[model samples]
Target: MLLLFIPIGIMVHLAEQLGKMQDNEAPFNEIMVYLGNFSITIGNILLPIFLFLSVIFFTSKLASNTEIVAILSSGISYNRFLRPYLIGATFVAVFMFFMGMFIVPNASIGFNEFQFKYLKKGRQDRVTENIFNQLNERDFIYVSRFDPVRQIGYNFTMEHFDENNVMEYKLSAANIRWVPSDTLYRLTSYVKRSIKGEKEIVETKRRLDTIFPFQINDLTPVSYIAETKNLFELNTFIEDQKRKGASNINSYILVKYKRWSLPITAFILTLIAVAVSAQKRRGGMGVNLAFGILVAFIYIFFDRVFGTLAEQSGFSPLLAVIVPNLLFGFLAFYLLKQAKR
Candidate 1:
């Protein structure tokens, strides 16, 4: 089922993106690489839904063949029957834990970077205009326009303040560019002003090479940066962003919480699949499969609704993740009880 669905998904995606690929003149090999990464990312996202349906299909078949009834009639308890399924779920949950924490983040980076670089025409990947940043307690930076690819900023200013909150010195440049090899910054049309005892001292230079405390990317924030980092990187990034008081800290927190919740999702989905299809109904496997699809869609919808609320408003990110699992946990418990009886 996974194999059949993957190709169909790729074909549908390729059809939708073909025009954009051609219009951008994207190379054949790079496009193929993007699609390969896309497959991994999409598969991880859809793994639970497919697993649920597959379980329902096979379990329903066992019921229809009387295999389950025969085993139960032989005095095997329902709890004993569920041992292997639960063990399988444990293995899958472990796999999901590693896949989400370590592997999928790389695929996410490649997928989103390729998307912003070539696919999103006339769209900016990072903020490039009227950007203001506080580098530290006493330092502030501004840029009129920034080019992330070139690592350059235009009309840049950095202001430094003294302990009393009075301006100590102000620096401005027509343009600033980072030199990767030399590990220095080049500033054009540079000017500096220093205030000492009400006397302003001015300095001017046509060009200057110096080091600054902040990175060039600091001028323009990447909107999808949180999705690109692996476990350790994301942890460090969240801590640093918190220190910097980032306005979108909630979004980063949401990503972190969601990654940690994937294992829990695997368990809940597996139990729900087993309980829902372990019985022979009038409609056979068709009814079980149809119900699986409905439940899978609802689970995804519930998750995304709370995720949006957490990221957009003041809702707790932890609560957003837990609520869906908690509700589904109740459903799984009720279904299992009915199946046992």
Candidate 2:
């Protein structure tokens, strides 16, 4: 565990330096502060998994070396030997779950802010493909592409509907910009047409300013766009979108569920580790280590696959987040049963 963290520390330092180079700015002390906080946050997030692996690796070696057999011959059941491991894993799992759900989210705000200032370097200030935002209770906006440098949107469309679910007005524009001074967004080089009672009124405008309830921060950034929000922020964002009547919220919902599920992976993997390596095999420590790594890789792969599906499909995010744990829990149970026999 001590050695594992050394590489993480090195990576954080390298990331900070890389940020400074990109922005042409001196390395700020604040960056180090954020890095330290972020590292701790990440460590907490991964601690359960580490604890699980540590328990399995050490205990498995003891069992392979005949220590477990000696203990079993002394009239102790294998389940009795698991008390310490389960206690430790439980503690770590609870810690990781709480930290991931409550603590890391807020810390990420600072972490991301530091990265944006020193590393991202105005890259996020611009908007790009598939921009979506909620305007009001009955209004929403979607744009195919936006160029912040030019303050123009390509294929911009705003939809407004009445309380009765009837289409009230729809506006399309080739380009749009925010007139900061007056707190208005101006659509330019565009045609404005409104439909009412099977009649359409079409007009051409050089510029039109309208009041909209969107801030720069309200726009999503391309990086860390998924699952970077804290519990409060995520809840608030969801409520805001719901109020604005936005349809798709599957991604955000998945992120919320994953915060709790990820920590439990540690405990489940630990059980699997102990079950896999408990038997005295001639292949020795090398074999146990290889098996451990393979299992870990498989677990990570399943996590990524489910995460991708949750975001893309209309599947329940809660189900997607918990499915890996559920599947592995069954595996662990099966292994434990086999080892006992």
Please report the candidate that would top TM-score against the real structure: 1
TM-score for candidate 1, residues paired by index: 0.90
lDDT of each: 0.89, 0.72
Model 2 scores worst on lDDT over the 10 consecutive residues at 217-226
Task: State the lDDT at 182 in candidate 1.
Answer: 96
- For residues 183-292, what per-residue lDDT tens digits would candidate 1 score against the true structure? 99999999999999889999999999999998898666688888778899999988877766676789899999998998888888888998999998999999999999
Clashing pairs in 2: none
Q: List CA RMSD, all candidates.
A: 2.4, 4.0
lDDT of 2 by residue, 102-125 (tens): 777777767776766666666663
- Candidate 2 has a TM-score of 0.77
